[model samples]
Target: MLDAHLTTQLKAYLEKVTQPIEIVASLDGSAKSAELNELLEEIAALSERISLVRRDDNERRPSFAINRVGSDVGVRFAGIPMGHEFTSLVLALLQVGGHPSKTAADVIEQVKNIEGDYHFETYFSLSCQNCPDVVQALNLMSVLNPNIQHVAIDGALYQDEVDARQVMSVPTVYLNGEVFGQGRMSLEQVLAKLDTGAGAREAEKLKNKEAFDMLVVGGGPAGSAAAIYAARKGIRTGVAAERFGGQVLDTMAIENFISIGYTEGPKLATALEQHVKDYDVDVMNLQRAERLLPAAESGGLIEVQLANGATLKSKTVILSTGARWRQMGVPGEDQYRNKGVAYCPHCDGPLFKGKRVAVIGGGNSGVEAAIDLAGITSHVTLIEFDSKLRADEVLQRKLHSLPNVDIIVSAQSTEVLGDGQKVNGLVYEDRVNGEVRRVELEGIFVQIGLLPNTEWLKGTLELSPRGEIVIDERGRTSLPGVFAAGDATTVPYKQIVIAMGAGSTAALSAFDHLMRLPVAAKPELVAA
Candidate 1:
């Protein structure tokens, strides 16, 4: 609801105005187009009135401006702009009605010359105060040029995707597919990126880079390390990832990883990604390699055919494709994932400190989580569908000794209970007695089994019986110039330090492979 004062002001303003007004009741239903239509109608009317009022006020110029450079300004809206930002919205609308400000005019001039379609996604929650200004700015830009496609995603409406993206704040702007800039950006800053035309084109060109010193597949720990090392060594390193950070970003916390004692998955991934950025490393975040063919023209260049119809050529390939956690396959599992339910205990356990929580599955991860949660929380219920805990006796003894921990044997989780916003508790049924009961708790942790993310590399690389990548002693794979490491590979002990060490090893080996090749290339490297 709007404040009474502003409502009164708006009502007064509306009563005096004869402009065609259409209120957007919700942030849905062709909002961009509708708002745009309304804005155009208002601007056109203002244009007509400007000539009549301009004779007396010579200093006051008319509103509205257009760019001749690219096509559009491309404003991406994220949330509903009401409340305090409403004023900002009105100002923006007024600016849109009048001539474009110097900054907006310059941006329009720059965007008019752009060749490709610029897709911008703005993420916002309803509670955000400054989001309306961003939405208005993007809408204005979209109206300025038809080439700009602005997408406003209401975080309140899509909480699941918000959580999945690990969006901690509102008004995050994504240019193209990568993060362009965060928070409220000045119109000039937005124009600078548009004028450069480098960031967006780099990813597209990477798809066609025929020859690289190092080709790092996947965007997990090992592959990132390998790519960073190779790039730092001045080797042309290209990383083809289905998604940047792979499975590592899905984790909530990584306590066991050495040096970085307690860090969120996305934070760690971001740190590594930042490191990769420090050098010239070509990272394809959302690109998937479809096939690996040995170079036909010699020089050890491996042609990596991508599913996106782009080919990546490299001298050495490092495969660090990691594994994923097995889901319970229960209904609402996907919807509730990362909301109230989670797969990685180490990442998200601290969120439930001093609260009662439940752990599903009695494997090593489950036992470890139960024991770990015991240190912070008061009560932890371990529900196992199997007859017994599959962890070692030492862990089992530790879990049994904890007074707050309860082990429910042969119990299966039927459904995750929550308010469709966040996890509040869970429901389980005893396999033996067939009795179902609801448990009230703060959160539920799922740690069933690990599933390798190697489906894409099935025919290309040799996989173990468990679906993990098969690697030699030095992280070398069955194929020449290809190596594997981390949890995705044959290395045992799926610990953070182990993965890190394995990644380091694969990186060094990949560097060695690249060094063994002919002419030296000092590739620029960046961490991803």
Candidate 2:
């Protein structure tokens, strides 16, 4: 079950169904199958137009086929639709119940005109917040065209298939038995891959010597802001990123972005990309910067070599490469990463609602996560490696005020304890007593410090001891014509608002540097 509020919302949403929709579930009386059947029955009870039909088919025991009353659009889900993916089931029902899709006209037309039979097998985890987007997109495409079929496979339930495919991550899409992608992908990106024979063109190189006046080397909130600010100056601006939404994509709920009372990471990321597209910023996705080199000619250009064997020359480069969460390097951590071990509390916390969970690390982030989870989960256990928590006094006071939170100091996490399916407990050492203990919990949230993505700039730019790029107040790096911002720099705090402000400052500094250059040395302004 859904809560009262969520049930009311789903009821209202399901009331719009004008045509009958049937959910045919194949079950074999297994535990997961029983859970899935109950979920389907509960959902089907919401509307008079919806019905659930259970078949005792051992071959596809845990699979469900969604079919419209009059049509034979093949859409199947082979897992329990819980957690964030519950939205996918609802959307699929609405799509099958005679509601027109909200996809773009061009995209719908393209989907309708596909020639060959394309089978998309999208492997996903229930806890993954980003998997629903890809699943919904593929399901919609399948509904639009009979030639295109999509099967949503739960990576946890079907371990044999997942291991056979070597799927180490959630949302691993396979097209015609080959790996298409590994993470969140947009509908347009998937369409592009379908158009071209290549699965997903994530690392394609530039065709010619692309140039820009201001080039941003990331695509998080910082890089998006920098590109928008630079484009406002009516100069040639370009942004290269491994993905359009850096760490933001991995995040879940984002309530700290000022003025925006509530929003999710993927929603904010989509808005950021749309805002950047509104300007003249040349965005190159799936391009990773490998090496940074100054041009042979003095005061000429900076060359950014990409992993795809393409080089980009720019007058100024703003480094906004974000940081990644530090891992505990414990056993079973990698094996059950998306299953029960998660780095993002905002993203995966809801999956453990009303269940016991533990937060690793007692700093600001760990305390914040514990506070946030206390209201949702049944219990919160905060474990710290240090003698005392390093969080601010205000945060500590607030954390202590919660009744459901328990703190353990000087506890060194040794290993993650999990069954072959998912995490069940955690093992840690009591530093003060020199004893090892296991804490029984269903989920573990790691809120350790971040590791800057500045390994490529080690010898090129001056970095701090923690490998963060050193930058002045004006965002200027030690190397001339190079600037750094956001988590990749020596910034004190790594917040979204702070990163956006830093990005704006870096863009202004680059503009000021360009304005001071001689007429011959200045970059040419291309028409927007």
Candidate 3:
């Protein structure tokens, strides 16, 4: 089932495996088992260093054990490793096959020192872009410490366990049968959790209490870029975010970030954080900004109230909270979310390659997603609620040029259909004929619109009708010292390159604002 291009890439990657790795597949008489067996066989054929063994086990059918040729690291997968989980499989094989772990030395030391017997059960969805990082981290840690065992579970395949655990989101990790984390977590964070035997709540306490000259809110590409730029100017820079990556974590492939030809969302996010850390930016993760109080007087300090009951003082604030994909809110949409219903095509499209898929909405995003998926997926059905598509003429024409794409207009998506496991089809209403129809497909991509992350700024900052913060050419808001960038602003297009540029503009504007202040009134620059 591997494409020629992907096959080549796999061969090159597998060449780095110095030690032999074995994949022991426990199979039952099920289609999911067959699919996984086929995938494993294909991967094994890529290199002689890898081997696949099958066993007819009834208890854990469709599960697999990944073992180094001689050493057993106790790494296992309870479901088909497709979508984002596919990366986990690749990385696990590499790690077990003698590839050195990339985790930092400090984190490795912490993992080595972890005392008690801990079994990490990470429940993830095939479509979740952030799941692989958490899974891979745990898997690597398991290899490093014999006391730690890691089991990666596909939530879609194990609905019973998911329901029992009340797992509402992907990348939900459990340590010793208790909730550990809900989203993407760095190795340091995981180690800290293991060391402290506490959850993220313990780490939310604000450490740096001093004032900052430039405080960038949000930690997406824009905010990270702004923080980096501001810190380079030798100013007191700080960044506060609920999570570092923001919506970038949900994104999959990124080929449009100028100069960089190819990269993934997680890779870019790591680079963004590292770049910010390279400077003196005070990064406060897991901290949400609840309220923003503009300075009463020009050049006065601004107060930012966080959800954790911590108030931060800053000379200037740049808002770059970014935006999230709009949901359909149809029946089964939420229930089967991340199962087969996904919001990001770039992240999950590869999982559905050679499978039938449907795209909701016919705007630029939807049409573009359809066009992009047509190259990987066997076929794509684009559904539009209006009589005609709302995408740009150029994009519509480009979409029509694809042979594997079908356009359906005047159609309203009514519900997502699943077989209690994963998405199997989508139900839509034919508005023109008043008929409801179900399209047989394995996945559904929703691309209706993006809701900016400026809801908290409502009634405080000057906002547009669409709830985006109103900004001038210099990325300045109506408030003198406050600025905004990225999708949270009135920018026309929402792209990574555009957001980075906007971030730089906002940082420059903030710096300009800071430079105009009197030396006695300016906040002292503290070395990060």
Candidate 4:
């Protein structure tokens, strides 16, 4: 009768409860028996207060993992999470609210010290799989904490962004808004900076301000030439480019460029870059211009907008955007590029010294490359899609006079043969035989004409059917105050000397346009 009455009263009390119940106690655990007795008393009280605690008896329940054995608290120590310690700690933390596993502890320690935002901008090309590690590290740091942000930029997709940042190498990470560290760095090194709070302080110190004057759009021969001239004229200049040396960087050797007749393309590019460094020019590497717009009325400034949202305002703008090698668009053409297949004989021909190499296409460029390669390599095979070489008679004569040079008429490259990584050789089909034959070679040069890089300017500027920018002799484009030079423009012959001359002409014309602008518009004309 007494128990039934008590149960009834308890049910009535439970029905009246509306708020969360709380229990607070500080038990002395120093004495073993006393601590156990206290814990038991607390547990008994908890069971009476909670129906769920009272319902469970022998089977493992919610508090089993946390329950102390005797009067001691169950604790574990970890030195290193080398083997299974890391996994064990992580699983324990996930399973119950105890000590974190060794691995989890280490991971926490690794990223816990990061107190401020870290912004990393890295460049990577499709060809570089090694950059994935860098991307993963930065991403891991970002995910582990809130104060870190990592951005992995594709070199090709964000060409303009890369150009604006002047990225020359892959895995170039910029912290906050300024360049932090470069190349492949270890996780420990990165952690050390975060742990010491140096990176956070450094990030806080960076200031956003305009630091450049005139930013030349390209870094081809013409662009470099223009930058050199502009810097020498006492103008603060910046050169933004996807690649510092431009397309010429891929060339192996140049025997035709005046003054320096015999030099590797990469070497020449390096020299040019060094020369620019000698001046006050701010060379921004690996940037691409996404848009060009007139700046707001700030004295006399013209702005070049990059894909990265960075803008360069200059008093004078010189566009020396160059052209790229025209691909055959054949089955294996792209697959073989820079492998057994090549675009510039001057760049890759030396690699085939004492070996066979094929020069594709029948135009003057093809004939010229074949003639040049024949002198350096042991054997040269000239494969032309057309029935005859379309070069000038003198070039044709020069090509035919070479004893080791074999001219294969009416032959077209059908397939480039090799693994996905590198080209081994190529398969060509003869118009007469309708049969295909493979030619083994150390390398192949695609000497077809280049395609102008003017697709972005399609509606904005006048372009020929071939897509070259149409400009006057003075390098002025159809649009007012716009000028173009180098291979992108409607220049007849594409050569270093010619591009340099055209760049000089364009720079002078741009200067003239800037001078004509009103004094109030000068700032707008010159902000970079």
Candidate 5:
């Protein structure tokens, strides 16, 4: 049940409800049901226009549906919507109770205009920082279109269903009983998947837009910062990113963001996005840049081609397309991905509760993942390709103290073993003796490393051997009027604060480059 502070906040929020709402509970004689019932009772107590009803018709026990009294608009939760999902629950309650959503009007219209049946079920974990976005987006979709029905299910509570469905990732969505997606997705992303013409329409709209003074190629911390800084100079700034949050959406925790002592990846990404939006930045999310074409002559317009065939022109461009998690390229790893291969321990560890799992790394992330998994899983096998763990002494000590964790150094993952449906074990090689060993595990969490998202920039910009954008100290790339920053650049430290600073530096450098351009070349582009 919500505590006093949360109850007060919920009561205040519920005061905005303009229509009667119904909370129908599907419960059984179980401890979880009792807990859910108590939570529902407390929720109903906070609002005069809200009422609770007891029902057991749902196949998923301890579930509940929030419905508007006179409409088909409703959303369901199959477990206690707490932790990161608490915001999702609150938003669902308000949205179903006639409170308006802050989603863009065009997007809401697109959702309402959708014609087909979409029964979406999102499997989530409480500790997952990314699940709420997918859950909330689908919840809003269901609220907008009566044909769309969505239920957010907690994988930890619905273990049997997760196993049966072979779900090995958080926020894994199923639309009409088929896999829709398996990561953090915004409302626009969900709409793009549903409305077939959405991408074309978006591309057409983008094509007609005027050119930008500074265009950012990503929307992570670095790109957000660059967009904000560029827009603050009273110039036309736009950000075209595949996803607004970039790889940060997959990240879980952050303890070293300067002033902020503690924060989550999604939270920081959201804040960065909002801050960028506060300026005159045109944030074009879910846009993937496929190619970059520099200006034909000095001080001319630079063009960026998107995957959708729309070309974005700018006086200056900043490339901040961040990196993604490195995958174990061993055999069967790709075939069994999401069947058992995972990246984030905070997200998928719950799905393997009480099952033996393997952590394939010895770095800080791997050791930390093992330490985190040791608490939830029956046992954790930490496999390191290095001679010793590269984690901090504190983390290594904590990992060693765990009773259910085993550390194996100088071992290389060779293959992932599965029973055609789900992972059953793993095969590795001892680097010291060249002996092959197989460990039985239900899941494998790969914490190996990250690879720069510079594949698209190949043959377009000067890149390091490791695929990072080669940049000078001032954030200027090898190409004139083109800059780079963040994890995709040659920056030594790939931290949030460093990325932000580099972003600002890149923006400033781009502005300087613009000012120093031929005075005659600026008028035509600026006027258009």
Candidate 6:
């Protein structure tokens, strides 16, 4: 199944294996099974220490497991691990074969010490960008601890099972036959759920840390830039985030990042994180800031309290908390959420295969979603609140050419219709003639816009009427020694490049603010 170039790369990567490994296939007499066997044989042939064997024991056909010769490393794939999951398969091979993993030492120990048996099955779409993280993390855990076992299933190939479980989203994980989580999750997040004491331990660690010269309040592009610039100044810098990637994790296509002509959202987010780690930035993931306490007086430390009761202090703080997906507040929308309502086409589009669905919005996201869904779903009805579509002309032309797609401009989504189980239809109002209409469908995809993640800073910081943090050209907030940037701020045109530039400017401004503080107030005096 792999091409010559990919085969060469896979062979080179497999050389990291320091011990013998076995590939056990649990496949049926099917085309997919034959293809998987071919791929596995090709992989085994590339390395002398690797061997393949057929063992059709698992009920899931076309599946295979990577096991260390003398150990019970339980990492398996339920389909051809290609597409976005190719890296996951590669990592599983190396890790299972006794090759070292880059996971933190503490985290590795924690995984190895977990108490109970965990059999996790994750359903993922091949096109999903977020699935690989969850898959790779769980696979690594399964390899590290025999108590844990993981199977990454391709939802498109295993549609029957996916439907039986009512999995409407990608990366939907089921542990011991129960829903565990349903999105992009890091290793720490998974451990925090399984190991109840992990949060308390992390909170305690944060509370005991020395005050940072600059503390970034998010880990998106903006927050990463701020942390990097501050760390380069040879001062203590820290970053705390609810999730490292922020809204970018849900984003799929990113064509306008400058220099890099084309890239995916999760890929860019990963690159941003790795770049930040290359510096001295202290990155704390899965930390949600509950409140902010401004300095009591000039030259005092700013305190940021997290939801887990941990408090972090800093000389100067940069607020780049970023924004989140905006939802359509129409009636029944919340009731039908996840049952048939979704936000990402790349992640959830597979579940709606051959079914009728509706796309709500007329912007680029909505139009692009319609275009993508048309290829999977039976039909796509695009409803827009505005008089006309706001998408680019090229996209509009492509959307118009799709036979299964229909556009409804000047219509507003009013309600989501469901039978108390799943979405069966939708209600809309025709703006042109003041008429109400209902479309019979099984899904609704909302692609409206973004809301600033500045809700926590409502009363603490000066905010614009639209809820964005108010900042000057130098990225200073109303509070002294506090600065803001990114989509969360009042920066015109919320773009990634702009957010990064703003973050750098805010970090520089924060440094200047600290330098002007009283000599005793400085964490350590800079040469200036």
TM-score of each: 0.53, 0.73, 0.72, 0.53, 0.97, 0.96
- State the displacement of the C-alpha of residue 250, model 4, in Å, after optimal TM-score superposition: 3.4
Sorted by lDDT, highest first, which candidate order results?
5, 6, 2, 3, 1, 4
**Collision pairs in model 6:** none
Candidate 5 or 2, higher TM-score: 5
Every model's Cα RMSD, please?
14.0, 6.4, 6.6, 23.6, 2.6, 3.0
Candidate 1 residue lDDT tens string, 1-528: 344675566544434332222222222335553453344344334333211111212111111222222333323223444433355445443433343443435456665656677777776544344344455556555656667666666654455665666543456677787877654444544664676654345447775566877778887777777777777778677777776666666554577777666875655775787788778987666666777776554445777777656678777777777777788888767776656576555434544556788899888778988998898777999999989889988899899999999999889898877777677778889899899988898677888878877777788768899889898889988787887778888898886667767877888887887666678688989898
Tens-digit lDDT track for model 2 on 82-108? 777888988888887878887779679
Which is better, 3 or 4, measured by lDDT? 3
Q: List the residue pairs that clash in candidate 2.
A: none
Top-lDDT structure, candidate number: 5
Better of 2 and 5 by lDDT: 5
Model 5: pairs clashing at backbone N, Cα or C within 3 Å: none
Report the C-alpha lDDT of model 6 over 12-43, residue by residue, as the tens digit.
99899999999999988899999999999999
lDDT of 3 by residue, 186-205 (tens): 67668766665433343344
Alpha carbon lDDT of each predicted model? 0.65, 0.85, 0.84, 0.61, 0.92, 0.92
What lDDT score goes with residue 130 in model 2? 84
Q: Name model 1 segments beyond 4 Å from true.
A: 1-204, 295-300, 330-358, 363-381, 390-406, 412-445, 515-528
Runs in model 4 lying further than 4 Å from the true structure: 1-213, 252-267, 294-301, 344-357, 363-380, 391-405, 418-443, 521-528
**Candidate 5 C-alpha lDDT tens digits along 1-528:** 788899999999999999999999999999999999999999999899999999899999989999999899999999999999999999999999999999989889888999978899999999999899999999999998999999999999999998888899988999899999997888888888777798998899999999899999999989998998898899999999999888888888899989889988998888999999898788899899998988875237999999998999998999999899999899999988988999989998899999999999999999999999999999999999989899999999999999999899999899999999989999999999999999998999999888999898899889999999999998998888999999999999888899999999999999999898876645545655
